[model samples]
Target: MDFKLSEEQQMLQDTAARLVRDAYGFEQRESYRRTKLGYGADFWAQLGELGLTGVPLPEAYGGFGGSGVDSMLVMTELGRGLCLEPYLQSVVYAGGLLAQLGDDAQKDRLLPAVASAQLQLAVAFEEPQSHYHLNDVQTRAEAVNGGWRLSGRKVAVIGGHSAGLVLVSARVSGGERDEDGIGLFLVDPQQAGVRRRVYPTVDGFKGCELFLDGAFVDAGSVLGEPGKAFAALRYQQGRAIAAQCAEAVGAMEATCDLTLDYLKTRKQFGVAIGSFQVLQHRMVDMRSELDQATSMAMLAACAADQPDSDERSRTLAAAKFIVTRAGRYIAEQSIQLHGGIGLTDEYAGSHYAKHLVMISHQFGDDDHHLQAYSRLMEVC
Candidate 1:
């Protein structure tokens, strides 16, 4: 497979890298994180101006019609910067869902705003007990006089704190854990019975726990086919997992670069620590791990478009396992090699390390994906 970045992809990557290097340095990130929104308004506008917010959506909706790989290039740079913006929740997680499942009217109405960063969205899918189980939907949406009444709690919702819209998954029919009864609805965050308890993630990104007490939605709010949203959910999640793996690869590579630089500049025994064989060996391993992880990230993005469902699942699970494991290793080694400075709040390395580590636990952890891969392999 050709691994070289295409010209457009390279341009996207370079533009983002330059923006982060020039404007989103460690000091800027610190200030951005301290805001009530956990990010800067101007920063988000800048990203939108750069065409990143629209990269993955259709041009009909004011996007650039970029594919998964093109979006991956943008994500890699965002990860390298340890961005605090809600682009992942807004674009990858929510915008992708809208692109796939939204009706023409809905897409025409909202996707343009989304692409321009005028609106942000978060999916309220995970319940407290959901863990990584996609089928577990305790949130219930019951038919009402003219629409639906939704009630449930969604925890650790990645961008829910500041979302203009929320895509809620609720059980419209069968039992709580049944996969067939799922329905997804677009809800207004400012609705009567919706509440959000916003907080920062371990890596200083925005997160929230949302409570919906009989939140009302009209029939028009239903996205795609009712009680038939599982396929769309799975498809969006597969894309999200692939995007995250790309981010992890970028984070790990950035961490490895930082570590290698630190080793060369920081002296020990009156000489550069990089001169020592042991530290040099560790740096070598870090680089190799990063390369392996990058390959898997690319593979995952490719597999997202595979025609066969089983092939896609098996390939995704396998790629996720490799990327998560490599991410963890790269994160830990970078910190260890940097000594005390690596953990300091002011250092970029610590944030990168935290982000990479936190990513392993997102979407699905190492054990979850490993077991999934094993099961898929068994069936194959």
Candidate 2:
């Protein structure tokens, strides 16, 4: 298969890269991290103005209607800059879910704002006990007076603290672990009975624990049929995983570049450390891992926009597994090559390492995807 980017894709990639290069310097990133929203609001608005926020959404709703490859190009640039915006959460994951599962009225109302970045969204599917199992929903949703009441807790809701709306998954019927009973609801964060406890994440980002105490929502807030949203949730999560793999590839590439540069400039034994044969071999290994990660990321991006199928699921799981492992290796190796300086927060390499390591934990980690891939193999 051909791998070269189309002219349009290259232009999108360059646009994202240029924006990141000009605006996301390390000190600037740190300042953004210190903001109330934990990212640069102006930078996010710039993304909207430039149409980057709409890259993967439907065109009918103020989007570009681009494919998953388009999203991959943008995400790679964001990862290279260690950007802390909620593009993955608000645009790719929540936006795709809305496009797939929302009714005509819901789509017409919400997607345009999301595409324009006028409204930020967060997803609350993970429970403390779910452990990455999309079907293991325990939060309860009950019908009441032509509406619904949700009561449960959602943990690690990334970007939840600042989101205007949060897409929450709850069980409306069947057993807690049953796949047939899950429902997705669009909830206003400021509504009665909703509470959020925000905190900083290990990788310098922020997230929140969402508490819903009988939060009420009208019928219009439900996405698709109640208790029928599990499939869509899983499918959109696969798309997010694909984008995440691409981001990891970008972080890995940045880490490799930093290590190689350090070796060339840092002196050891009256010469550049890069002149040593041992370190040179390690650098070669890091590059090999990056190359492998790049291939898997490309495979994931190609498959992410395709119709849902067993093949697509299997490919995504495999891609995520490979990329997670490669990212971990690259992160560790980059830090080691940089020695003590790499661990300092002031250095870009350290931040890249942290971001690379954290990428594994999102969606699912290496071991989780490995098991998922194994199960799919058995099904095949």
Candidate 3:
């Protein structure tokens, strides 16, 4: 129940905030958006070198051996900076899964590269029809030639185009959405029949649609037990969503601060707009929502690392749903309060707004999470 941040956590937050302000500012983000990578390679390298990428990883894997809270803190700062780098993809999605389920051999081979930023990863789970359920995957991984032949289409795969490896979720037995018989496998992007078409998302990040036709993976490539992969993947996804919720909270915080600062200086009727009661009320409302989102983010992060599966699902869903709804409202209010200039690209509001929009939809939207919450509540 203690809510205070430790000194180390405070230092990490300060460091991240400073780094974003000094290096990952608006102009830098704009410049990097046009690059083929759609992000700063050097900045990512620096983060890796600084051990930020390995903060939540195990010490045995060349990481800092920190807990999930550490990763949440870092991602929160990344969001505050409006960072375009795919830190979530490499760390939360790929690394979390690998650490939790991959064997020691897999860890020895992949964790070092990930820790050093020498290799990047992306998770391929979504399908054209499979919706947001982690176990709703329809991609098939049929046994073939002493291995598996994967053939399916995954859409909206973040960072897939540039990933050195892709951890894919496929259905072993051909059928519609079901939790049973699902499998997770590591696939090399250079393999034949694995195609990635990269595209830009609204938040200035790269997402790709993967077409795997007869893509082969050795038996050793499976990350975990075939029929039991869903729980592990879902756990990793909850953690990933928790990180994103924290990130959204960060963006909302920045949005509120930016709006408040603008109100203080912006003149209307020959006076500071902030002095107006109506404007002050709007700012107060934004701050309230931001605070709620932050609280929910912390709850979700804690729940994500919990040992109880049922509790983790419920807490995560509730937290995600609450944060998504509140964060969206705050971002929209920020843009509206900023007036016509807010919608323009030059203004920082637009960037934060776009990121908020993307975050709201990622992993699960408000509606998705709400349904999950309902289902969990009914079961419990």
Candidate 4:
């Protein structure tokens, strides 16, 4: 298999890197973080103009007709910039689901809006009771005369505060955790019986807790098949995992570069700390981990497109698990190498470090993926 990126892919990567470097300075990022939106609105619009908003969608829908590799490249730059935009929520989670399962009408209506950045979306899937359980939906979607009435509470709806649309998961029948009988519906947060309490995460992102008490939706509101969305949901989640791993790799890369800069500039005992053999060795280890994470990210990008479900799961789990390990090592090492100021808000290391922490816990932690990898090994 050809491992190098195509020329088009290289241009995409370079464009992403340049945008992040030029538009996202540390002070400007702080200004954006202090806003109520918890991210930069204008910067998000700029991403749309640059065609990044539709990296993974089809060209017919105003996208660039790209795939996992393309999306991975953009996500790495986002990570390096420590971006707080809702790309993961709008593009990867909501758009991926709609593309994979939405009818032609649904795709035509929503995907174009998404690609043009006219509609912002947040996915409501996590519950207080279901920890990282993608199919463990407890929200009920009972049949009404002409549609369905949803009733359940979802906690920590990422990017909900600024979303123009929300896609929800609800159980139509079967048990709470059953993969079958699960359904996804498009709902407006302003609709009747929908209550939201928005808040900011420690990593400087906006999220919300949604209480849906009999929110009504027409039969047409269902995005995919009536009672069969689990497979599509899983597939979207695998893609998300791959994209996120790439982002973590980017953060690790930035931290490694930042730490090296610090070592070269920060002097101790009238000499550059970087000249010390022990310090140089430590930086080498950090760089090595960053390289490993990058390789794993490529593996994940490829795995997301695999035809076999088992292969996708195994490879994604392995990639996520490795990212978790490598990201933590890089973040911790960065802070230690930079001294007390590494975690201070004035410096960039703290922000990257915090983002890495958040990424580690997202979807699943190291332990979660480690167990999955072991189980896959047993099956093999």
Cα lDDT of all candidates, in order?
0.87, 0.93, 0.87, 0.89
Worst 10 residues of 1 by lDDT: 302-311
lDDT of 2 by residue, 227-254 (tens): 9999999999999999999888878888
Tell me each candidate's RMSD, in Å, in order: 1.2, 0.7, 1.2, 1.2
The top-ranked prediction according to lDDT is 2
- Clash tally, candidates in order: 0, 0, 0, 0
Off by over 4 Å in 2: none
Better of 2 and 3 by lDDT: 2
lDDT of 3: 0.87
| Per-model TM-score versus the true fold | 0.97, 0.99, 0.97, 0.97
Best of the candidates, TM-score: 2
Candidate 1: where is the Cα deviation over 4 Å?
A: none
Tens-digit lDDT string for candidate 3 (76-190)? 9999989988789888889989998899899999998898788889999888877787778778888888899999899989999899999999989645667878899999988
Using lDDT as the yardstick, the better of models 1 and 2 is 2
